[model samples]
Target: MPNEIPSRQELIDRAAELVPLLQKNALWGEENRRLHEENLDALTESGLLNLRVPTRYGGYESDMRTVVDVIAELGRGDGSTAWVMSVFAISTWMAGLFPDEVQDEIFAKPGVRVSGILSPTATAVPAEGGVLLNGKWSFNSGVLHSSWNTNAAVLLTPEGPQPVMVAIPVADLEIVDDWHTAGLRASGSVTTVARDLFVPEARVLPMGPVLQGQHRSQANADSPVFRAPFMATACATISAPAVGLARAAKESFFERLPGRKITYTTYENQAEAPVTHLQVAEAVTRIDEAEFHARRAAGLVDANAAAGKPWTLEERARVRLDLGSVCRRAKEAVDILNDASGGSSVFTTVPIQRIERDVQTLNLHAILHPNTNFELYGRVACGLEPNTLYV
Candidate 1:
């Protein structure tokens, strides 16, 4: 069957229908740690997974805000699926940032998909047209659904030193199937390996310099699609699901409040108690704060792109910090909400337990790690040196 291009609303609507099934299967996805074929087909057919590709290659090319909204909505149902889709969709956009010839080769087929685990853990040897890549990439979310992947490789040429993005055909790469985790377990994030794979010159892109808004791809000269710093803003995609899971936690906590019994208390319903009010309000308030900033970062980045200027390093760091902060706040809020449930929310059938673990798990992402991002932002702001060039 052919993949169909869907409007932004259609994707949201489709996600609306699928979320419930996902919610029912949330634990199943977590236990399996991989997306089910049924859900993959639905997303692919609806085109929810194709937002970032260029219009010429059959993508929606919608702004980042729309993408955030859709992914957030999906997150409210299942954290794993949302995380995978967000990364996959963003990688599609990142592909546009590659050279035009690279784009032509990768997206030559309609509705083709791309997924990556952007750890930059590969080696690139200078070859005739491009570089021969060899190394392993881990945490490749949506690995099962993608036809191609963007693997980060350090450019090692006799001429000089450089960092590069190497496009690898999914068929040529090997999956290590080693993803085992407590949170976002459904992401089935496996490791991919490539050894001495031949890549054309245009297929390899410089990492450090191009991320600052210069690239060999002249096709992007006429379009602002590739003008934005999709790398620094990367955490936004991962963070959106945390916000959504927090929202779900808030909702689930409230739905049970009216009829919940308090351990040994005379009152059978906890909603009437003052402690319930305090915890619920705190959870709701924090989740609201998370929502605002998550949207704020995406809106600001998209607004800048629409304005024709590229995203700055500070702004990029801000996205990283803000995203990490939001994820942390969301998890904290949910923790409070979980406490409000006494002991019932801890059961296997309750689902809150899954969400709680998922939120905590998302906190471990390198880009979304609060302490690391805060220190990076703090250093950059105070005129100290940053640890990594990417974020």
Candidate 2:
């Protein structure tokens, strides 16, 4: 790692350079149901893992635009890798929102990795110094390789049930190897069980304030990169993988197009067929649209952070809209390309099948689902109160 922060373009270039390595490890990652060790080492060496860490901790503290760009480049290589990295970026940013002392503890390690999920599936009770937390959080992506987890849980306060984010070491939780899935298999998003785990008060952050851009970290308060709303930043960062996956499908399709023929048809060259032309055109268009939405969403976050502007309800809803649009468009692109891929594309050796599955999985995510996000945006646009606090 360099003593000085790298420029946005430099970080993006580093990510692009890791594409072949991530691609090479994709199959192995899928087979073993976790990111390859070599992939982890490569990410650490690239300093990409520290993208969202505070500058005082030797991290770049890059803006949201740079974050999405780097993640998209990683997505072009492997969707699982991209997804895991995206989660890390979001989680690390969340870590920065904690009290300064907590940040010091978490960011002190070299090449620290933190995995997290927003769903408050656990419960926390008052304890001596902090809270005694216990519950199970599923879909904890990258947990196996992570040193910490910023999990959400419901706190049993005297006032009632309060949602809170608790930072806990990975060793304190019991790992369950249950990440069997048709898509994003390499993410290692398994279930983690926390049984009577004691978390210090410094490690527990109230979610309500954090969601509204009122973070507790005095040290990071003035930092532009940490000024944006949490959900907006998260939505922007997570949307990048969809765009990259679409591009991956396009790459896979065009790479194999020259030698491929329309089987059982008169067309000797698939690329010459009018239907192929239409499919290619449609897929390319959707991919471009996906990129457009991704960039717009990231731009919104970056601009707001730099200006220190408070996010309007409509703007927040629109960020969610952008996320959904990216997922929907990217999936559409991958579907068009996958449909055109034919039977040979089903082989494990082919990249399109994996890209298709990955995009499909992303679209199905609760937060990333196209229909849910569209409905939320539409509701907010119609002058109704947002149904969820997540936005």
Candidate 3:
């Protein structure tokens, strides 16, 4: 960590410079099923890992727009790296929801990278000083390089099981290398298991209120970046990377267009064909549309945070809707580019293949899926409550 925090633009510019290196590491990361150490070093050195940390704790304390923009730049380089960074970045924000004491202990140290899953998949029974937690959480992105894992467990009270968040050191949890997937392989989003681990009461945070815009980081109480409603901004954080992946596909396609010829066609070069022109136009428009929705959702999240008010149900639902649109359009744009690039583009060596696979995986995410969010939004629009708990 540096004594002086870099400006938001400085952070974005730094991420832009790292694109090539990230791209270079993409294949190795995929092979090893984790991010290369060099990529981690680059992210740490650039201060991008601390994008959501508090300024008082040597973090940039960037707004939602800046955070998403930085992630977008990283996405342009490599989808997996951007996905991991986005997950860890939001995990840092989630850390602020912990008690002030817990925040001090975690953020007071430098190079504190945290990763987590929001699902309450474990059970927390009352103990002497804390609670005994036992559960297994899957899809914990960036867990390999993380210092801590912030997860949720159901608290067993007399009434019933109430969900609560807990931050546990990486040393205490068991990492299960079960992340065998065709896409986003470098993310290392594996399963994490905790058996009979005791978490101090101080580390416990109420999940329901946190989603409703309540947090306990007194050091960040005055910062609008930390005051944002967790659920309202959650979709924007993950969806921004999809938009970036679309942009990466666009760049990759054009770069390969110069000498490429349509096989057995009248046009010598693919770029010279009228059909190619239409493909480019449609793909670019779809990419732009995805970016538009992503930016709009991010702006709304920032505005709501700046106001320090809870987001209404309608507002939160709209964010989800916007994120769904972003995911749908981004994947479609990448598919168009992939198809336009011809059969050669599907080769493993071609960057478009990986980009296509990554965008498809991203679109399948439960929260960002078009149909799921569309249904959720429609339920809310019809004067009915949402079926899911997060919103």
Better of 2 and 3 by lDDT: 2
RMSD of each: 2.6, 1.1, 1.4
TM-score of 2: 0.99
Lowest-sum lDDT 10-residue window in model 3: 1-10
TM-score: model 1 vs. ground truth: 0.93
The alpha-carbon deviation from the true structure for residue 152 of candidate 1, after best TM-score superposition, in angstroms, is 0.5
Evaluated at residue 141, the lDDT of candidate 3 is: 91
lDDT of 1 by residue, 101-147 (tens): 88898889877878876778988888777678888888888877789
Comparing candidate 1 with candidate 3, which one achieves the higher TM-score? 3
List candidate 3 stretches off by more than 4 Å. 1-3
> Candidates' lDDT values, in order?
0.79, 0.94, 0.89
Better of 1 and 2 by lDDT: 2
Measured with C-alpha atoms, the lDDT of residue 358 in candidate 2 is: 97
For candidate 2, write residues 291-388 as lDDT tens digits: 99999999999998889888999999999999999999999999999999999999999999999999999999999999999999999999999999
Model 2 off-target regions past 4 Å?
1-3
How many clashes show up per model? 3, 0, 0
